[model samples]
Target: MTRLPVLRTPRLTLRGWTFADTAAALDVYGHAEVARWLSPEMTRVPTPSAMRLLITRWIAECVGLPPPAGRWAIERDEDKRVVGGAVLLRLPPGHEDLEIGWQLHPDVWGNGYASEATYALAGWAFSHDVDEIFAVVRPDNARAAATVRRNGMLWVGETRKYFDLDLEIYRLRSADLKLGAQTSQRPPGHGNDD
Candidate 1:
C-alpha cells in the first residue's frame, strides 16, 4: 500500500497519528459533547488503556487497512496541537461507497474547520478514485448537517446503521467536484468557506 501523505490547509495540518498525540486524543474523545453525535461507544470517556487501543486502531487504519481507508489528525497551524480528527472509510463489500467523518473541539465549533477539512478530504478521495463520498449525520446535529450541505452534499434521506439508529445521510458524487472547486476559490471567512 502507498503511504498516505500529509495535507495542509490555511490554518490546519492533516497528518498521520502518533503516540505523542495521546493526550490530545484523550481530551477530544473524552469530551461527551464532542462524542454525542458520534457512535455511543465513543461517548463514554475512555481510560488510558482504551485510548491506547483507539490510537492503535487509528494507526492500523492509517496503514491502509480495510475498515479505514484514511484518517488524519487535524492540527492547528499556530500551535500544532491536535484539535480534531478527520476520517475517510471505505464501506463494506455490499455498500461499495466511501464515508467521510470529522470531530473537533467545541472551542473551534464556529470556525469552519470542519467544513474546510471535509472539503479537503472529499477532494482528496475523489482525486484518488473513490467513486462517491457521504456522511451519516445525526438528524439533531444541525451544525454537522450544515457543514455537509456547505460542502455540496445532498440529503439522501435517512437510514439505520449497525448502531441501530436512524441517521440522515448526505452524499456527494465524484462528478460533484464543483463543491471542492467552489470551496477552494473562496477566501477564508467568506460565504461557503464556512
Candidate 2:
C-alpha cells in the first residue's frame, strides 16, 4: 500500500488525514445531511472524540508501510482547511475493485470539489497501476452520480458488491480519463508542481 501524495487541483488540495483534522472531521461526519448518505451505524459517530479515534486509526493504517486503501481529506486551497473527505479504497472483503467516494460539507454541496478530488484520486490510482476505479452510490444520490459522470465514469447499473448494500456502480479506466488526469496525480513525495 503506497502512501497517498499530496494532490493539487485548481481549487483544492488532497492530502493525508491527521489528528489535527479531528474537529473538521467530526463536523463533516456528524452533520445529519452528510451522514444520511452513509450507513446507519456511521451516523452514530457524532462526537469529536469518536471522530478522533476513527482518524487515529485511519492514519495508522494508511500513513504507514503497506497502507490499506483509505480516505484523504479534501482541503480548500484558499483557506487551508478540510471541507470534505474523499476515498480511493478497495472494496471490502474481496478488495477486488477500488472504490471512490466523497462527503463534502453541506455548505459546499453544489461546488465541484467532489469531482476535482475524485479526478485526482482516479489519476493517482491509475498512475499506481490500478486498472479500474469505481464509485458506488445509492441510486437516488444524483449528486454523487453526477460527480462520477463528470469524471468520465460509465454507469454499470446495480450490484450489492460492496457494503452489502445494493448500489449503483460507476467505473472509469485510465484510458477513459479525460485529458490531464495522468499528469494531475503527482507521485508520493512528488509535490503538486503541476
* Local distance difference test scores for all models: 0.75, 0.75
- What does candidate 2's lDDT look like per residue over 1-194, in tens digits? 46667888888998899889999988888888788897433664678889999888777768653432567898999988899888777677697888877888888776667767777787778777778888888888777776577667888889886778888988898776774354434442233211
The residue-by-residue lDDT of candidate 1 on 60-162, one tens digit each, is 7677554336878899899988999888876443546678988898777767788768767877887776777888888888878877887778898898763
Q: What TM-score would each prediction reach against the true structure? A: 0.86, 0.85
After the best TM-score superposition of candidate 1, give how far the Cα of residue 70 lies from its true spot, in angstroms. 1.2
**Residue pairs with clashing backbones, model 1:** none
Best prediction by TM-score: 1
59: Cα error in model 1, Å: 0.5
The true-versus-predicted C-alpha distance at residue 119 of model 1, in Å, is 1.7
Residues forming the 10-long window of minimal summed lDDT in candidate 1: 185-194
Q: lDDT of model 2 at residue 186?
A: 41
